[model samples]
Target: MRENEGGQERPGGEVEEPFGFWRGGGAHERVATGFEETPFGEVWERFLESVDTTNVGALTIGYWGADYDTHFVYPVPLLVEAAASFPNLRSIFLGDIEAGQSEISWINHGDITPLLEAFPALERLKVRGADGLVLEPVKHESLRVLRFESGGLPAGVVRAVAGSDLPKLADLGLWLGDEAYGGDSAVDDLAPILSGERLPSLRHLALDDSQFQDEIAEAVASAPVVARLATLSLAMGTLTDRGAEALLSGQPLTHLRKLDLSYHYLSEPMMARVCAALPGVEVDLDDQQEPDEGEFYVEVAE
Candidate 1:
């Protein structure tokens, strides 16, 4: 719907009222209900209303691939306003941003600070490819699930998550991409996550693309409160069979039922060896991949 306000086109085109809906009010009021030259703020308010209806207990929104431009054309402030209004919102998933521009050029921006502060009941947050996903002061206690992908959990992010008073959190996912880049030390950087008695209620840990070098194995192996963890994912990393073996060796992850090691280089025998070490645990080694011998200086098992 194209709106011509004094012969000027609106940013989101024009608004057309749904003709089929019955309106009890006068024509002007009825038309105003649906037809308005919506500014970015109005668009965000409408978005909040659409998602907040029915008082739904949980709402999950995902933005992936090149589609980010479509959902993020609005200014950051408006988006923050929209996010804060969703009282019942639980999970937020984000992935692959082709055009990374909004409130901040990076994925970890300070704009999301207000939303985290306002939503006290927020539960799950999964962010991937959001370059500007900076740390925000968290006030939500009902939060349970947290996941990150394609980016390292920076110091600010780890500090924020660790400092949160989320007593109900269970699932924690962190994927810090390949280790060759500055990500090799990511595991060590997340020391606060495993330090002391933090994340007491955390039960499941999913780590994909993040290399947990041997340096932090002790921290991961000795995580005091993650004993109840039932599932673990260690996909796409420099994690050797040794690291996997080390991570599960004499660890509190005795409750692990599912383990995914896809895209990592591991032979059937090494995989079998790891599985034998953790009897009863199902290990997924179906998609094991290794760099070509010419490209890789290290010996790779088939």
Candidate 2:
């Protein structure tokens, strides 16, 4: 059917209603009549028809397989609009299927304040390779988890989150690409988040890196006092003895229960050092094993 840029209906073919997930598509449920193809907006309205509850648990949408390139030039707004339509929506997972779409560019083009403004019920947000988000102004009471994947993020984005009223937030995850790794990276600028006035309510933080190693560890160790932080996952492309030391020594995650340092970048010496430093944090299954040093062991708390 033909439609204007605003998604307003013109005239022609019948509006294509949103097909739900089922084995046989439209054959499973009686198609709703009077459904007009008004554009993407109408499609989205039809999509919202599937939601019956005033409150929602989560809303996640992104490219899968070839959809990454063949689909919309930008899908964040559609997902965000869905969140707005559902006042109960709690969490969002806007991640792409990385297996084949890793090469696509994710550049931040403008501010993301409008999205936050539209979805006041938003709580947990996960975006990978979503760019141009001015996250400083978002102030949602239900928000507690914020995770970003790739693309250049302005320095102090986390600190800006600290300024918001996301007190219930318990997890924060950030990943900077190879350009911001190691000593030459922007690891130092994250001090605001790792130091004073940090996200004090945080309980978990995961940082996935493509290149940076030792510098990333040091930066993580220096994170500000998050009294509830219990887990730290570092997925670095490269890690050395110094990196392990930086990750293990110092900082206060006294209640920390899990630490994942399994990248092959760590040498035997580095692994040993981590065992010595953390005392009881276990080696992730992905890491290789050697003779027991008997210095430390980890058990899932019962």
Candidate 3:
């Protein structure tokens, strides 16, 4: 199932998609817009004199329509002075502009840990609209995939990634939004990644698009990071059936291989008992909306 180039499906690899500015590891380049009639630091100094940031790897700084409320393309000190001429940079995706450049719950992020400590061989990081985002407690030594695509994700950026110290993190996603777009983040502010004590070589956990998704699926089915996930996305939340019966009454998740639970609400007898409680996993219960505005909701608010 080879597909890559953002046409996705690379279960194996040979990936290199992103174009404009450039991209590498999980490549992503897309920077050219209305130019807001030019002069946002001279269009990032003409995108730093037309790329070739010494073999770029990933970059995206899209559309600042209406100059993002008075020229807001901070570009973290021009991408940390262009990550010292990017000798094969790791990854970065910031404000890839959507909701027509305004309503990814009102984009306006900043204070990005000085380009994550000026890209100390950054591994992967994605940030979409989190309203003046910032970070502290960082301890990166070869960071690995930490994404935040907000429609409102802030409780000081989920406690600054549960007090950062990413020991080779392995893909942790978040979009817990809707405290009127600043998403105050409480479920006791995700008690240190739901008691997994933060990414311990995590294998892909997406606590996606939330409104507390059944209290984060009963605390991620008794998470000690769900026994080190293989892939466990709680896709586009508002998951009903009391959160798929608190994710089938916990414990035996059969060492999950995949369990997306897409755009949920679950009823055809609890989505057929959550696909017979994962009969060899791979269960992505697709778009099943039912109850109108009274109950089921999380597809992204605001």
Clashing pairs in 3: 23-57, 23-58, 24-57
Rank by TM-score, descending?
1, 2, 3
Error of 2 at 249 (Å): 4.3
Model 3: weakest 10-residue lDDT segment is 1-10
Model 2: residues >4 Å from true position, as ranges?
Answer: 1-45, 49-55, 64-73, 79-84, 101-111, 131-134, 151-165, 180-185, 226-228, 248-254, 283-302
Model 3, 123-157: lDDT tens digits are 87777777767766687888867778776788887
C-alpha lDDT of all candidate models, in order: 0.49, 0.49, 0.72
Poorest lDDT segment (10 consecutive residues) of candidate 1: 26-35
TM-score of each: 0.66, 0.65, 0.36
Sorted by lDDT (best first), the order is 3, 2, 1
Number of backbone collisions per candidate:
15, 12, 3
- The lDDT leader among the candidates is 3
lDDT of 2 by residue, 1-302 (tens): 10101211213853312111222111221211111223334444565677553544555543432223333334456555555446655555554324243332343224455666777766666665534445664557666667765533444454455456565666676654444321123655556555535455666666554345466677777656444456676653345566677766767544566676654356666666666665555445254423246221111000
